[model samples]
Target: MEFKRTNMCGELRSQDIGKSVVLMGWVGKKRNLGSLVFIDLRDKTGITQIVVREEDKDNYKKAREISQEYVIEVKGSVRERESKNSEIPTGDIEIVADKINILDSANTPPIYIKDDDDVSENLKLKYRYLDMRKPSVQKNLKLRSDIIRTAREYMYEHGFTEVETPFLTKPTPEGARDYVVPSRINEGKFYALPQSPQLLKQILMIGSLDRYFQVVKCFRDEDLRANRQPEFTQLDLEMSFANQDDVIEMNEGLIKELFDKYTDYDLELPIARMDYKEAMDSYGSDKPDLRYGYKIQNVSEIFKDSDFKVFSDNTLEGRSVRAINFKNLADKYSRKQLDKLTDFVKDYGLKGLSYIKYQEEIQSSIKKFLTDDILEKLKEALNLEDNDLVLIGADKDKTVLEGMGALRRKVAKDNDLYEKEYALCWVVNFPMFEYSEEEGRYVSQHHPFTMPNEEDIDLLLTEPGKVRTQAYDIVINGDEMGGGSVRINNSDLQEKVFEALNLTEEDIKNKFGFFIEALKYGTPPHAGLAYGLDRLIMLFAKTENIKDVIAFPKTQSATCPLSEAPSPIDDRALNELSIKLDKE
Candidate 1:
């Protein structure tokens, strides 16, 4: 390119007419229209039209030869387009080229450089550099940046100091498996990537950083889903002298501000709060999508007296009876289709699914076992109408909720019952500890640092099943966008919590000794939340895949196609760390 680029592809307008300007970008589209050669130049901002006329014979010939995505710089005079293209931002303006210089040429991209391009995910990921050229991809990145900026600004306004915690730290055993970094200096001592800055942030609070915030990176070597990534960013925050309500209110302001700035939809303030039990009972999901009307109803009372063995057998003790009426779905599903759904919930440990169809007359396989009064009562409890399908899950309390939860989401999605407009809610009062049969012990549902509700402390020891913690999750449209809890400030409560989780004194000392020591040094009652910024951005961008919002994201197997990570380290490098590969 002979001349320096002066204007962005999207910045030129009629007001700049006749002004000499230089523009550089990839060729969006090129065509030879009679005597004039037209080229659409595209950059991250947008696209602009450039015209090389026969009057400028040299430039016209040069422009006619360039293909899409060819890098070029053009020196021209900005002019009002003779034929306006109303579709683009710079449609009314055009550049009449006097000089054209091709900087680089390109082969055709594997994926289309448009938002609505239909290409396999593998191809898109393989050529991510080219795929990110689309205007939508650029906008997603910008939107993500804006959200992070707004969060930082909000935290600063509320007297929060941004802090950076160590990425390579000692591994804590409670959470997901960590990606370990071998240490050369300290042989046999490995540094594990921080799953979260949970401990360090608390230590920061104790160190008298009253309000601390960090837009930080966190790593978890875990199984991936559409929303999960190996390496993800989080808006990690913590505050001293702040309770659960204080943390919630501060974040609510940040959320509202982000939505108000980035979207046209107004966020409902003081978003609806549901206790964990309520969320489980009514919506069958912790992160409930409250857009539609498919609430899970407890039908135990209706079937308690019924002769149906399925319902009666499951309700012996630690079991539940739950049903979801997908209103008017009898015609939408068949026996085979229902069978597929049964298999879907089975992944979540559900034994089987029992369903009844309500048409002009009552119809069900189990109807024969029920008397007329019992059938009427069942219909009344489920609020059944003609063509309604009442899907039932009778199992242990956990499996019933899990099965119905999965079914509720599946039905809502298939029926197009979801509202695109966001619905935000806080799912609160989570169980402090959940019994982990595999581990043969109770484990902290949130984290060991979480404070139990004051009144529930007694039950934490005796009736552990009934205890609730001061934990809350910011659930947006069936996704857990973020979650946190008030920390146990008192030493006694913290000790009891650790004991309940079956962590011995030695185990606690080894794992969280520093944290326990910090709590004794006048630690203020604090609470914090970490937002999965990538997931949050994905939701706001109306994308279901987290990879779409993330630049150069890894695959479901946590492999980066672009970089091909988890590659074999050189023998010399491994030898320095005193490690050797022993493959089977």
Candidate 2:
């Protein structure tokens, strides 16, 4: 603590040899070689080798006692390493210690501070501070900071003003369940965390902010997935007087800048755009992975007169019979593997998966039910070839699309069919509303604020299911990086949308009264988008687990093992909020 540090552990090089320097970091590793001690000192930048000899008896004693992760400062002279390490930048030089100060000693860590340390995720989360010392983990955090800085630079360059919205506000009607906080000041009342700054940003547009952006946190009380967390960060932005084209163009430029800065891949301007309907019809997913091709082909017409009940019955009932041609994988999937695929589709509500193996001759589970004419039509429709396998899903359109979409990704991964380093596309013209069987009513697909397409506005009342909105999503590979829509600026249009969603007048007043009132005061035509900052970092870092990019993420059950959050509070605190726990 007495000596001021002059350099980071990882910053020294052979060029700086013979210069005396002071460095501070953790003891990454240590070894005693007879009268000499060798240590690898590590900091956030990287690691550097430190040498101490018995000639400096006091410092050598201290160095020999230094253990992994021990905090220390060293006054040393830089010298060329006897054997250079080509793997690291600081590998060419070593630090010869004149003095060693053990600032703080550390107990052996529960988890190793190495990238390849195989440990349970729960244990890693519990010992996150130690896990974060790994170079790989630190790299992700540094990259995340760089990405945020780049995003802010781009936003400012585009005349966007950065603004912060409230974290605690009233709960909105649609979207995922909110994580509400009991308001002690208001007694029984509660304040819900913002899901995205969706309504608030729209309000900003109404207030003539012109352009706004925020790197903010969002929360949702929803089931967790590999790529999702209950609490996450997003780069939320909105623009006044902007239509769908204006929003899309501005965002495309931002995306180009981000990729150009963080990745070697140069993105083409005006990225390819696909309609939602077309994406679903071809790839069976709105967020289609365009890196590989195993497009879903509709064979409903080809099976119209077939004796196969699964296909014929589905077609007659206005359902679909779709197939994916996994070319040259016919021999790869055995009967057991095919049965596993059937079970996979079952998860998506499909009764079963039917497949045809085209090897030397036709081999299939339902070939006996198909006549020669029907078989020939199917072969022609799917463009069958030798060693081609065709997997079929016959069910309602939604079920078929979901099942085939999952299968397509699995097949691509199993066969190593990725054809590009990055595949980015925009999905547009999404449905305005979809019927919710659970609620027995129509609900907004994106949100109630999304503006319906001009041509489809008339169908909002009569055929809400068929109406398309000016909504769009940016999809990278197979993940939906982010999505947004043009907002309805007119108060009348907003009311009509609420009515179409079956929101009673009282319900509207309770959930969106202020938003509607703001629309009445000269709200401009606006559109906005929010990108999942975590997902973006994952893509840039080339990591599969979302937790790897996050600093302190929760487990799948939404519990933080490190801090043990969402734990019971003192009775006095709950009593002050006029709340009581309900007995199970």
Q: Candidate 1 — which residues are off by over 4 angstroms?
A: none
- Report the C-alpha lDDT of model 2 over 1-584, residue by residue, as the tens digit: 96998998778887899999999999999988888899999999999999999999899889878898999999989999998999999999999999899999999999889998999999999999999999999999999999999899999999999999999999985479999999989888999998888989999998999999999999999999989999999999999988989989999988998899989997998899999999999998999999998899999998877888879999999999999998889999999999999999899899999989987778899979767787678678888889999999999999999899999999899889999989999999999999999999999889999999999989989999999999999999989998999999998988899889999999999988998888888988999999998999999999988998999999999999999986999889889999999968
RMSD (Cα, Å) for all candidates, in order, is: 1.7, 1.0
lDDT of 1 by residue, 412-460 (tens): 8888987667888999999887888899988888888888888999887
In candidate 2 the C-alpha lDDT for residue 50 amounts to 93
Best by TM-score: 2
lDDT of each: 0.87, 0.92
Q: 562 in model 2: Cα distance from truth in Å?
A: 1.2
Report the Cα lDDT for candidate 2.
Answer: 0.92
